[model samples]
Target: MAKRKGKGPTPKAEDRHWHGKRQKARAAKNAKRTGTPTMGPSGRPTATDSPRPSGRPAGARRAAGDSPELVTGRNPVVEALRAGVPGTALYVMSGTDERIRESIQMAADRRIPLLETGKNELDRLTDGAVHQGIALQVRPYRYAHPDDLLKGTAPLIVALDGITDPRNLGAIVRSAAAFGATGVVVPERRAAGVTAGAWKTSAGTLASVPVAQATNLTRQLKAYQQAGCFVAGLDARGSTPVADLEVASGPFVLVVGSEGKGLGRLVADTCDMLVTIPMPGKAESLNAGVAAGIALYEISRLRS
Candidate 1:
């Protein structure tokens, strides 16, 4: 233990290009163990080269943001593995087909790991954007309160004041989980979380909704209008019309704004109704997740 004097030599042009790449990798592994036909280094002929397997495996050199990528698509990786979304990893790209290989074998029957890689290494792990070639790394989207959506069952909620993208907050949480709306409210300082191109444009609806982030969205829309609910506010200077808003009768709350400023005056005075979405053509507004899915399908056809 007393001779530790290492870090001392090899720098003359990296020791003559590391001894000419260690003698051309020992003459291409002795001409690939001797039928004598080697060439490569792009001079071609290593039997039309496409071999590649001499290195990478210390976690494949890991670094694209050191993981937590999730570049989404293919039904948001089968709805983020049927919305359990815990510990995910799923990468997929190399020749993906059979419905993205049955959504990566339903994210490997739920143990989640997947991996694959190729489409230019998943476009260099999602930096080139459009990860429609499917990409996922996982862990981040969590939010769920307002008393766990008031013990859920059809609560109807939406908020989103300063809607900062993330693919329009994963397509307004896949149109508030396809019309019945149970939870979603943003603005933890002008938002945009649940990434992976907003879960590939929320084809998985950010893994079965429940967003809640507010720090005081006009006092949680006046505490969802003192609990009896009904808070509407999608204003194109609305005077009611989201096909006559009511949103699934019972408990409601829909306030959409900030696509270049739409409803913010203490969140449109804690709305009790402002409604809009009647666009008689010549589009002026609609795309805050299609005006929050036409104001949550007019609050689910005024609660059936």
Candidate 2:
């Protein structure tokens, strides 16, 4: 050899194997700390990247035991499940009730978590309401914008001016779904949003009906008017009768007022026509839901 001795001793096989193991351990630790997959040699996700099927995603599993809506009663829970409500879990009291069994089966069918708890816990979850030994934890409802209602195929829509009753809102939603109304619009403030009660009252029809919230109902009515929809306000002393209204066959927005007050002056004035459902008896008026249902029925009939 010509004195060319610059190379050091080659590493042993054991050393090389230990170094490879150390690198893999470090990579796995880093992956665990960052909650990401261990990158492969090509910097791509591998089979190890698959998350363990332990619990729900982060922030989805509520530890505080508070849910957005706790749907109580067997019928309500069953209907909610049938309506495809986004349920987190189903809580059934420790019993052998057939309804609870049905609920459990339904939840299992939908992959919804099922928990067996004491009746007292169910009562606590429902705030002492009549839970009927069952409760469903559902996600909050997401309301659409006023314009979304107008984009549907059906031009018939219902606008609630000041209806604050959640049941009425739910009934209106149910009626809207039944009568082929495209959607329902309510004011964003001073009115009822879709709540658990509304969902229950709607008999699961809330899933199909799109409810929109408007910043300014009068402005929304004006916008509907500009869009070639006849804005009609339901009132006692309206100019047009629900039965004889010619615009029912066309694109129309039926505006129902609050239970106590008929309609606001601005909203009533903004209407292209005022409609009254004829009552043969001396009853002054009807509830918001009944009135809306009647109007929807007449419109549906006219369209058919």
Candidate 3:
């Protein structure tokens, strides 16, 4: 048999989400008018439902670092520090590098513990990633409950479904903060958690915009609907454009999904409305971050 050929270098995390595909919009052969997922006879998930790397199963992408909580590298560490990512300690090795000294100074200023160790230990700490003799251990993120986001008379909340990328979560939080969203809700499992990458990309907005974790996203969405909140999920198959949402001025929850998979089956069904962002551009769809930003902007405009 012929040997398996290589797939070439992997794409970056930011570029992998719905970026490579450029085909024209095709009708969802099995999709219903409601845009719900069609299951196989055995009730197993379809090809789109199967867990694969990024949106396209053919191409793969690697994350920027070994771990989200342990931010490593000279530039990343400094940027995380500048972005005010909450940290417990700053690990470093003795070196004349100016960035290392600068990291030490910042850690000292922020009262983060400084743990000097050998290069070997640094590599081990970073899981053999390129550390450049520095790493920062981010404090474990504190997640909120779904109900805690219900604040004020008409609160807006953003819930993420199938969005495992922390950067996308950060971008959504930033949008949420701008549009007066109460907080963000994410599934406790199979979803992105607040991490150093999230903090950096959020530009510290995560601090103000608390992210709540839900054990069952579908249940939480139902609960929101029961509590008199309009639930909307962003999807390419949505009939109603986001700008025309009828319940914008009321208590609302906007759900965003991953780039490739869009909204999961049950989560999409849970939404009161599946809202689409009408993109007249040649592109077929937008990533979660961009989609959330546009949807939130439209919702805010409607509320205003």
- Candidate 3 residues 1-304, lDDT tens each? 9999999999875677664342212324324333344566878444332121111111112222222257778888888888888876777887578888888899999898787778876655555677787877776677888999999889999999998888898899998998889999999887887877788889999889989999999999999999889998999989999998969899999999888999999999888889999988899779899999999999999999
Which 10-residue span in candidate 2 carries the lowest summed lDDT?
57-66
Q: Which scores better on lDDT, 2 or 3?
A: 3
What is the descending lDDT order? 3, 2, 1
Measured against the true structure, the TM-scores of the candidates, in listed sequence, are 0.28, 0.69, 0.76
Model 1 earns a TM-score of 0.28
Worst 10 residues of 1 by lDDT: 53-62
Residues 1-304 of candidate 2 have per-residue lDDT tens digits of 5888677888886677688888778887886656576666987554334222222222112212122566777777777676666776777875477777877888899898776777766555555677778777776677888888886444898999889888899899999999999999999888887876677678888888899989999999999988878888999979678878877778889999987898999999999889999888988889999999999898898888
- lDDT, candidate 3, residue 153? 87
lDDT of 1 by residue, 44-129 (tens): 34322222212122211112222344435666556655555453566676534665777777777877766566677665555455
Candidate 2 is scored at a TM of 0.69
Best by lDDT: 3
* Candidate 1: stretches off by over 4 Å: 1-79, 83-105, 108-161, 164-168, 171-173, 176-189, 193-238, 244-255, 258-262, 265-294, 299-304
The true-structure Cα RMSD of candidate 3 reads 19.2
The Cα error of candidate 3 at residue 110, in Å, is 1.2
- RMSD, every candidate, angstroms: 16.9, 10.5, 19.2
- Which candidate tops TM-score? 3
